[model samples]
Target: MARGPVGQITRGTTGTNRLRRVDRWIARHPALRRAADPLVVDLGYGASGVTALELHARLARARPDVEVLGLEIDPERVSRARAQLELVRAGGASFAPDARVSFARGGFEVPVPGGRRPAVIRAFNVLRQYDEAEVPDAWSTMAARLSPDGLLVEGTCDEIGRIATWVAVGTDAAPRTLTVSLRLAGLQHPSIAAERLPKALIHHNVPGERVHAFLGALDSEWERAASVSPFGPVHRWRTALSALVDAGWPVRERSRWRLGEVTVPWEAVAPG
Candidate 1:
């Protein structure tokens, strides 16, 4: 509770590709798609910098010359990641060439070295440690650090990257949409995403909130679509999503739903 030694140390749990879904999503985002200089921030990358490195490599496929910086509140963790990246760079693996993906020490302030506002900021599993009441302020602080055409993607995910939900925000600090991505092969119910919702919507999964109503409707649709389960969970999920749209949920597209993801306009399920 003290001040966290210059920057707050998070739970520090991380693994390879633990944030792949979000990374893939960011790669295709219109903000990063048209950026002249695609600078991205991996805020609170936990004990390891693997997720940051992975994000750089993944985005490079689309942006070709994307820059990623991993920021951690714990100096020790940052030092560890810096050493690993140095070793990789010495080996000539272009994944982190010229230190395009590097580590630093910072908190919600997002202290980028040269005071550069990044085009995209991805903070996965960072705010889940804070009280829900603190989410909006955190979102504001991070969003304000984005470039005029930037986006802030903040979310939570399971360690294995099985389920994830993130809110994409514009530079004005307004959340645009919430996206839920999961593996549909064995998905029981869409609401299972509640466990991994971003700090903003995690607590709002209770009664009387739009998110609560949204999940409730998803459960209902999933039940109605159970007949399709014999074909496969994926088929059942698609059916459930169709049912949701019929029920007027303002669902995104079948293309995304086929990939086990569903995005809704922010106002649709935003907290009241």
Candidate 2:
């Protein structure tokens, strides 16, 4: 008589290290670092649970007590992940045997046992398949399950994980920041991030939209900063991003430029 998971099944396309860009970002977030519970959820983790294991391994470097729970709506996926975990526990896998991780069957409702609310919920490429009109409700349903100071990181990335974009949503379901991370080596242009933008702003990347203008500026700066390419992509990125700061882009986190990352207030690209 119980109800079913609140979301739909996804294509389950996954690859090793495909989420490294995002995982590094989450490890530094306060929701995972300073949480009283330090419970992180990998919601809709596709057909494999390796991403969840990878997340735990990376985060544990910062929060040794961090716990990662991989949730999937399909019971079969849950079984498969548990089987993978068993190998890990038996020293047959690469991850630490005592890694604090688990697998569960759930969805956007984010069902967790022990009355524990997750400090961070990461749903990547889960909502991109849904219609744009349904994004808000999906975000609200997931964000509502977070702790008071928790964060909901939702985003999309390329198949190989070179380009990525995500939104940091608060417990109120209001988006706080938009981040674009790319592999600077042999990069074409920063505007390439537009193709991987999260669902909320993907369709709004047309002319007259704020996101479009932002990407335009990003590409323009990248092109203008080509003079520094001989030095290195990091130098090129810093030079380009510095120009944006001077041009009044309201870019945040100057230190992250070395990583080819740019974080801006959500309002910067919110749909007009």
Candidate 3:
């Protein structure tokens, strides 16, 4: 193995607010809210440092002491983000002047000072370029750098923030839940999230597969819930989620349904 970062460099596509959905989910996660060390890692945070800044702003609302460390394997990208961080520190950016954010060159090995472990690691869109067979090892490598009660969030989303899906992995390196979040208004169907499924489950979205079955069920319930559309997309979304629960799907986090998001136990949609 090479003596450096454990992963390959990928497309640096990034935009403002592109990760709001996942950031919202992480902000509310117990892993950050209750951790002894409220340190968060924004691994592979693309071309700009804005996502890391946004993550800290969002997480700080819940855990005032939350610190975000943005990691990238590419040295130039790291330098560029550090420049952005300086602007923020100088109060030239929209974020807080002293936002607890930093940039470093690292990958799945998740290097930090003095063997410190992170409370949550958000590795969004970083694994899309890797072979599906490589996901477990990648996840295990990152998860090993987490605190005992920490979480590793891995997922993908569209260019805009509308549709997103992520898996919450525990320090044990086992995926616990899969969450699908979308912009309900004007959405044709809930299953559009299939296009953005995380690398771990994207290819498994096929006929006779667990994910295929789950999205199929979601689309069906979405169509069936159309009668309540007049009440607005949020209500319609809540209806579909309620029906999914009724239909025996192990859906969780009912409070988030109104936001056009639903989470299910990983086993419910893991490839079979």
Compare the candidates by lDDT and give the number of the best one. 2
Q: Candidate 3's residue-wise lDDT over 138-229, tens digit each? A: 99999999999999999999998899999999999999999999999899988899989999999999999999999999999999999999
Which scores better on lDDT, 1 or 3? 3
* Candidate 2 CA-lDDT value: 0.95
lDDT score, candidate 1, position 84: 80
TM-score of each: 0.92, 0.99, 0.98
Collision pairs in model 3: none
- Residues 1-272 of candidate 1 have per-residue lDDT tens digits of 54442335679899887888888889889889998769999999988888888898899889878899898888898999998898778875546565468888887778777878899999889889888878888888898889889999999999899899999988888999999999887778889999998888887888999999998998899889988788988888889999899989998846777778889999988888
Q: What is the C-alpha lDDT of each candidate?
A: 0.86, 0.95, 0.94
Kindly list the per-residue Cα lDDT of model 2 for residues 1-272, writing each as its tens digit.
99999999899988899999999999998788889999999999988999999999999999999999999998999999999999999999899999999999999999999889999999999999999999999999999999999999999999999999999999999999999999999998998998899999999999999999999999999999999899999999999999999999999988888998999999999999
Residue-level lDDT for 83 in candidate 1: 88
In model 1, which runs have C-alpha deviations exceeding 4 angstroms? 1-7, 92-99
Ranking by lDDT: 2, 3, 1
Worst 10 residues of 2 by lDDT: 25-34
Cα displacement (angstroms), candidate 3, residue 70, comes to 0.3
